[model samples]
Target: MKLVRYRPAAGEAAMPGLIDGAGRLRDLSGHIPDLAGEALGRAAVERLAALDVESLPPVPGQARLAPPVAGTRNFIAVGLNYRDHARETGMAVPAEPVLFSKAAGALAGPYDDVVIPEGATQVDWELELAVVIGERVHRADEAEAARAVAGYCICNDVSERHWQMGGTGQWLKGKSAPTFGPLGPWLVTPDEVGDVSALAMSLTLNGEVMQQSSTAEMIFPPVFLISYISRFMTLEPGDVVTTGTPAGVGMAHGRYLRPGDAMRLDIEGLGHQRQVVR
Candidate 1:
């Protein structure tokens, strides 16, 4: 099932929802509080999947979407996890996953405007596959880590390269800007997603293809990354770990985003996201 969090109108509280078989949005608010915390666990998700989708009230007209999962305490990220991405930057592939964190506040609706931080130069895009953890786990094995996943979604790991590489070189500074993390269209379950490794993903800037690759290119896939991360920090339900982006970032071609530039990111099965740079 495709779960979502959305607002019926501006200033309204976000309500839990799902996309039914007919591709219509149906309300799940009565069944759950929000799509976060324990609601993201495997057993909880399975219970939700059993509900009669058609009987739920339809969310009329267009509602503004929020990131699929909420109450995320840790918004972790992997860097140089994609081989082509590493190559494009002339950086050596790390034997282990290079991890970083994006402030949870940076999360935004998929179609929200990506405000270019003031005085920022070298604003860029990194289209990534985001994983939402379903249960608390630490020191998990690959199989256990795999089972801990609740769902997947698309994430735009928008960046400010100058802050990322300049000064003391703290990656979080460049990655944690407001509106920097645009996620979701839906939080698709694992059963529906099938083979996560084979999904095709890409990003287009102003209608032109900029990044294109498959999860198959990832050096440390989701399960491995999850397990690796668990060895250090305990991952909780609703926590998000964004697997790194593919090649073709703006930095490689000196084509950073400017005001009015639009980005559309697509990950197979997870759905797509559109954001206008402002």
Candidate 2:
């Protein structure tokens, strides 16, 4: 089922629902408050699925979409997990995942505008598959890690090179700009996406295709990534794990985003995201 969080009008409170075939949204929160149940969002799906469709309320056409995962506790990212991206960035392929965190304030709707900071010139887009954890686990094994996953979504790992590599080594400086992280049109459950490594992904900037690669190219898969990270920090529900972007970022070509550039990205059945650099 396509799960989403949307506001029927501007300034209206966001609500969760399941996206129907006619493009109407079936309100899940009406019956399942807080989107919590036996398995969090999944339980809502099971209960909602048993209801009569004709009895459910229809959502407005003008509703504004919000990030699928609301109140993300920790938005963590893996760097250079894609071999080609590592090569383009002039970094060695890591034997283990290189992890970093983005401030939660950076989160925005998938279709939101990305405001390029003043005096910033090296803005780039990274289309990545983000994993949403379902349950809390510490030092989880690979098998347990697989079970801990809740869903998947599309993420644009927007970056500013000057702040990233020039001033300090902390990637958070370059990554934490407001509206830098655009996440999701939907948060797809794991059953919808079995075998995460076979998915295809791409990024188009202003109608130009700049990056195209497959999850098959990932140096470290999601299961191993979750397991590795859990050894160092406890994984909690709603904590996001952004897998890495493929090659062909603007920085690699010495090009950067300018006002009016639009970005479109997708990862197979997970969902798609579009953002304009303002």
Candidate 3:
């Protein structure tokens, strides 16, 4: 099932909803308090799928979409996990997964404006598959990690090359500006999404394709990343773990974003996103 957090119209509050088999959205706002938590329990997907969508109110076609999940306490990220991206950045493929954190404030809706900071000259785009954790786990195993996953969504790990490389070399400062992490079109459950690792991912600057690669190229897939990360920190409900992007970022080609640049991103099965630099 594909789920969303949306506001029905201007100034209306956002709430959780399910995109049914026919593509219409049914509000699930009151029924499930914490979908991430519910999705982790035994027979969870089956139970959620069993909800009577027909009885729920239909969401307006023009509803403003929010990132599918909210209250993301830990916005974790993996770096250089794709071989081609690592090569383009001229960084060695890490022997183990590379981890980093982005401030939770960076999260934004799929179609929201991507603000270009003042005096910023090197903003960039990164297309990645972001995993939304469904349950809490401390030092989870592979099988446990797989079950703990709530779903997947499209994420643009927007970056600023200047701050990323300029600092003491830490990535968070450059990565966590508000609206940098634009996520969702919807959250697609694992059961509904087949072969998560082989999905195609692409990002286009305006109308030109800038980054295009498959998740198949990931050096460390979602399951492994989850397991590895759990060993170091606790993974909790509603937390987001964004896998690294592939090659063709603006920084690699010296093609940074401009005030009027438009970005379009798509991930197979998951969905697409549109953003414009402000």
Among all candidates shown, the one with the greatest TM-score: 1
- Give the TM-score (vs. native) of candidate 3: 0.95
Better of 1 and 3 by lDDT: 1
Q: Which candidate order results from sorting by TM-score in descending order? A: 1, 3, 2
What is the C-alpha local distance difference test score of candidate 1? 0.93
TM-score on alpha carbons, each prediction: 0.99, 0.93, 0.95
lDDT of each residue in 1-278, candidate 1, tens digit only: 99999999998888999999888999999989999899999899999988878899999999999989989999999999999999999999998999999999999999999999888998999999999999998999999999999999999999999999999999999999999999898999999998899799999998999998999999998998999999999999999999999999999999999999999999988889999988
Tens-digit lDDT string for candidate 2 (149-214): 878889898999898988656699999899988988887878777888879888998888999999
Compare the candidates by lDDT and give the number of the best one: 1
CA lDDT scores, all candidates in order: 0.93, 0.83, 0.88
The positional error of residue 97 in candidate 1, measured at the CA in angstroms, is: 0.4
Residue 128 Cα positional deviation in candidate 3, in Å, after optimal superposition: 0.2
- Please identify model 3 stretches exceeding 4 Å from their true place: 34-45
| lDDT at position 264, candidate 2 | 91
Compared with the true structure, what per-residue lDDT tens digits does model 3 show for residues 1-278?
A: 89898888877667888888798878886676545565434376667688777888887677888888876789999999999999999999999998999999999999999998776778989999999998887899999999888889999999988888885876997899999999999999888897887898899988999988999889999988999999999988788999999999999898888888899999999889999999
lDDT of 2: 0.83
Q: Ranking under lDDT, best-scoring first? A: 1, 3, 2
Cα RMSDs, all models? 0.8, 1.9, 1.6
